[model samples]
Target: MKKSISNSLLLLSGIIILASCHSKKQLVKRQADSSAVRTDNAASAVKNKINAIKSKQVSFTTFSGKAKTKLNVNGNSNDVTMNIRIQKNQKIWVSITAVIGIEVARALITPDSILVINKLQSVYIKKPFSYIYTYASRQVNYKTVESLLVGNAIPELLNENGKLEPSNGNVVIDGQLQDLLYKLIIGPDLKVTSTDLSNQSAGQSLHIDNSAFVQADGRVIPSEIAFSSTVKNKTIQADLKYSKTEFDQPLDFPFSIPSRFSQVN
Candidate 1:
């Protein structure tokens, strides 16, 4: 009788241990399945956001705006008023005025060339469009600059195969362009909130933040833009706040370099 009782207790103990191990395994499996479901849902959300942005392309022949601009280069800051005009892909004209409302510099940017006239110094710069890249990242171009001004994603990033994930209540798209790593943060409304581009090899990075959106011509436009860049141990920052803006209006872009101004190399 004693032997039978001991045998029965051992059998019961073995059964309990096996059941506990099986329960643990089942719990782990369930957790993994739940995690995968969450991942799939997040990915689907990102895909939908990307498609929505691609569908709504702001169509306009002309864009113009007035803004107060603050520029800081190497700790020196200057406040100025800016008048900007854009004729689609053809031209971008900008005039910079001082506190007295006197225009001190004007710039005209085209697809192939860039022209600038400085009234204060009596100098003009005429160079290939690539020249602007010297002051900015190598990926800087006409479309990139225009997109930055209007708070849109660059064509390269949008059209590329990128990895999308959710972070801090925003969808982030990450990709590489021209040997640079780029991250674009998109808000819930499918508008881009900020862009970050980094070139690890050169130790350079560019950050742009857009906010204060307003509806114009059935599209949302950013009213404030903050730009910061670091290149070769030097940093420059610019803040632009738009006071007035209009789109799809017939506009004129007039640019003529003063003949007497010396050309800068």
Candidate 2:
């Protein structure tokens, strides 16, 4: 009778151990599955956010604005007024005036070419669109310039090379697009707060801050923007505050260099 009782107790203990082990395995599997689901949900949310931002971009036939501009070049600072006009996807015209309302410079930029009139020097510069590369980085294009002026994300960066990361409650999209590493910080309101681009091999970088939204033509637009670019150890920074903004308005981009002005390469 004693031996039978001992045998029964050992059998019961083994059964209990087996059941506990099975329970533990099931619990671990459930935990892993839950984590994976959470990750998938996060990825989906990020994709949705990116799509929403793209859809909400401002669309218009024309744009005109007056900006209070402050420029800094190699420690020299000047305040000027910039009257800007844009025929969407066609041309951008700018007239820069001194503090006393004297026009000092004007520029006309098209998809293929760039022309500038320097009133102070009585010189005009005409070159292909690639001329911009002399001052800015090689990654800059016509679309890039248009997007920067309007606080829109770079179209090239929204591709497979970009990754959206959430850090410290900020949404940052960063990746290598071409030879440049770019990061675009987005605000909670889904607008771009800032953009940063750098090329390690070339020692070049561009930084832009976009802020102060104003509504025009049923669209929100950035009214304040700051740009800083460094190329080959030279740095240029400009801060623009838009006091007047209009969209879809009939605008004129008249740019004609004077015959007396000398050509600059």
Candidate 3:
């Protein structure tokens, strides 16, 4: 039972890539017409649209959500309910519950450390943040994780020099950051519809698709998110459907390993 709970927690952490941070920028008006004719200065228009999308990024000191998550890996599938909370640039807390609402695992992630307690096994794992790079790619970090969870442009991708192009009736922003190539698709509503990040030399790729945007606290946020990644030919996928979410709400992050529990590594 402990092994099962550990595996489930590990899988959830890998799939969620949970992290948090805050940034403020200007919001650009949403482009309502997808069929608008492109002018000779289409490049300028596209750049403006990308900028607007970045500007409207949601900023909050804290966030909390209850989600139903489905994870599939190498042909096996599992469903779990996650209670997640984020304190920008500080920590991410998650509780995983299994059958009959029994709490099985809890994780607390910070900028410098990762900690998970397997209540079923009475064991815990404590490692540095760098431990996550082993599961995904070297490009996976706190900022990227945070951005991915909230459906915002990754900081590294945003900083890179990029080109704007048209693809399948939407605007595609392409760029290379370090060894990774990224293509971001932006819709007429100025929201990101999808993002693809690939490192050809490493044969690793991460793709995220978001939809079902609804207004929350005066900000538009994606309620449905799909994440998929292929690392060394092993594929992992997760879909998150947030049922309740809010920002700036007072929340408690309680974590204490029982004295009887033993540490693993």
Candidate 4:
């Protein structure tokens, strides 16, 4: 009887041990399944957000906080500041001022053409959109400026068939061998995410949270945009703030040149 009792006790111990081990395995499996479900939910949310942005017909005014490198007779350095404006339907007119001892530059862009009237030079350079995009990277962020002119964001709005993935923490949109999506989230008061666009080239990144939001001409506009770019080994940063924004105001889209500004390209 003593031997039988001892055997029974040993059998009970073995069964308990096996049960504990099985429970642990089940717990691990449950945890993994939960993690996968969460990941799937997050991905679905991102896809939904993209769809929402695409479905909307949005008109907005923007304030920009910009940092950009100005290559000049002097040397390379940083400039930052605010610009304000209203933009819609591939047309924008903005006056940009600077901080850090730099002068303001004013610009107007349309779908077919871009007219940049320089306050410092007292000169106006008008050119086609394609020509400007190819040659203008040296002056401004070619991708961002192009998107504003078209009233849409690239890759987000243009590269509809690009690869979307999460890198680090931010979502990256990549196009055939070129990465066209980059953005930074900022925190402060104004609460905005600034973005840098390369449109398939190596680009820049920057952000400011407390930029500005302004109402203009019956529409809401982002009163500030912060930017960063790398043109060579140098990094350029900038802020653009718009004081006035107007939308649905009548102007020629793909604006035609007055004879005075007309020269066949």
Highest lDDT scorer:
3
In candidate 4, which residue ranges exceed 4 Å CA deviation?
1-47, 55-57, 60-87, 96-105, 135-194, 199-224, 233-235, 241-265
What's the best-to-worst order under TM-score? 3, 2, 1, 4
How big is the positional error of residue 216 in model 1, measured in Å on the Cα after superposition?
2.0
**Judged by lDDT against the true structure, how good is candidate 1?**
0.64
The ten-residue window of minimal lDDT in model 1 covers 16-25
Say which candidate scores most in TM-score.
Answer: 3
Q: Write the per-residue lDDT of candidate 3 for residues 5-85, one digit (tens) a residue.
A: 467577546544442212222223445455343423366665556556677677888888877777666656767677888
lDDT of 4 by residue, 4-103 (tens): 2222212211111000000011111001111111112355654653454343223444322222222111133323222323343344444333444543
**What's the lDDT for candidate 4?**
0.33
Q: Which residues of candidate 3, in runs, are more than 4 Å off?
A: 1-5, 15-47
Winner of 3 and 4 under TM-score: 3
Model 2 lDDT-worst window of ten: 16-25
Candidate 2 or 1, higher TM-score: 2
Clash list (residue pairs), candidate 3: none
Instruction: Report the Cα RMSD per candidate.
Output: 24.3, 25.7, 5.1, 24.8
lDDT tens readout by residue for model 1, 115-161:
76777777777778776555455776677656666777776787436
- TM-score for each prediction? 0.80, 0.81, 0.84, 0.46
